[model samples]
Target: MKVIKKMSMTMALIAASATAAFASGQQAEEISYYEPGASIESIVVDAAGKGQVGNWGLGNEYEVQALLTKYGQPTTYLSQAFDMDGFDDDSILLASAMTYNELGLVKNSYDGGYSYGEGVSYIDMNDEGVAMLEDNLFTTAAFAAENPETVKAFIYASMKGWAYACENPEEAAEIVFNYGSSVSPEHQAYMAEQVKKLVETDTMGNMVRDYGKMDEAAMAQTLELAKTYIKLEDSVAASALEAMSLEDVMDASYWEMAMGSSGAFSPEKSEVSIQLKWLPQSQFMGYYVALDKGFYEEVGLSVNIIPGGGDIGETTAVYTGQVDFGVTWVSNLIAANAGGMGLLEVAQVYQRSGLVLVYKTN
Candidate 1:
């Protein structure tokens, strides 16, 4: 698996490669890992083959614009201009690919051509050098300073939640759905399974026992790419973002504290809320499972799980201190950091990018 992954990563950097990403619960069984890069390429090429433009599978207008800039925007880029209704029937030549959920919708769609022989044509953002970390836990530096123990407890509780979810994805899926995930029950389950793969392993296919450790190297790569591809509104903002070092963006002491203490969770008690990136979904199953299973309570936290929506932005809410902690993508954080928001990452949930570029293969 290591050899294959290294080869895949090398090939992808040179040009592009047809890769397939698949996720099913391990369920006491070891499943083969997919090269995230190849899987992404297959999906993108599939969409492009059919004459569609490509972009990130998720993000708002601002983030999407950043994605286009990062990818060397296609001349026909128009994801927001048209919805998914008649994209396949018309000459829509671009579509954002999300490996975890939306891209799955395409493979299951009527008749999209594929690049990986029986698979599809796409490109993984990670491979294309635009891989940004997603679903990271973050908070304002003031909170960390005011309540260092509280920070440690939350990290411990959250890591427990993720570990449990990865090991028991079906149960985790049910928890996410019941927590108000707007997606169908089946879709939630699919997301649960995929997220499990990410939280449990590194991109190289090795098991990662440290559940919430931030990959500093990957984080650095994310920052560099964001600087190149994303343009901040003002030069000052852009300069601030470019000036940030990983130390400014991350404070790992709390995570280390959590790692040092491994006894059964026992806490006096504290209360706080965490805002998620979106409404209830399997992508955030770990936190939900923690809340549902009382892991937060075990760690002495009385957590108020705030669901995210149209008006509820994770980075903004965290920056304003509206929530004690927030779940968000690393790219958004970079944008905010560049714009003078002093948000810091506490825990990294997903080890790999689920975002991909999908296009028509025909």
Candidate 2:
């Protein structure tokens, strides 16, 4: 599947507000706000189209629009300029915050955070049933078909890495920090804690021990959401997207086979490289931990991790043979497959969605 460098940004006018919602001098323990499960209707309707919402425009823009429309609220999409400053000034009343990244920044005071304490609440996409799958393991169909053992080996090592990372987040964060993290050390540690939640938690807020096993229900939901949001300009591609099924984009056999074995697979390719979805951070700490812990080497593979965030995306890089495997969102793989790249997702790394609509309650 051919993937674009970035998703198209939806246009909207950003509304600015000078209202300060928090007193930074207050102790964190003295503050409290709405519980996390607060209804979307409560926040969106109250905003009344004046409190502008922001998204990073990776793919969660669709989820934001879907939520607003579901609640019978009309909103123009805000593509960028979301930060703690935006929240402090009330210029951005609502913004997309990933649990592993932005959410950590919003809650952490040591790393120049908002320090709003418990005065903020969020709408989780997973709970709303509008979540699309985030980070996943994928490769071109031809690559997997030609090198099944290598694929299995990679999956085995990768999942082992993930399991370890989830169990020992602090050490995993330290390992990633030593690998040259893109965020601060404190923020990286915070990310490691939050990322463990995504990796091991389910949509129902239940803890799941399966690290990289593909959840069938979640995958179907993601495919359905992708069909609704991933717009293709090419008529043929658009048609392909509508007609695509989970089978067309995923091959669970490799994940299954890898899980069945206790690190006993002999790889056809001893040396392989993977491209990540973004820069070096605890968000992708599993791979770094796997490399650091010698999990890849244990599986008879020498894995090279290529940091992402260049002009090319992980899907495009993997599709063009720039990398043997890649980490990307399920929606991105769907779009690429619609364009006929035939990329196959091997494993779903993140069990739950991390995208949350964060806003202040007072």
Q: For residues 226-290, could you state the per-residue lDDT of candidate 2 as single tens digits?
A: 88777678999999999999999998999998899877887888889999988899999889999
lDDT by residue (205-251, candidate 1, tens digit) is 56778988888887877667666656666989878877878887788
TM-score of 1: 0.76
Q: Estimate each model's TM-score.
A: 0.76, 0.87
lDDT of candidate 2? 0.81
Clashes in model 2: which pairs?
A: 1-336, 1-341, 1-342
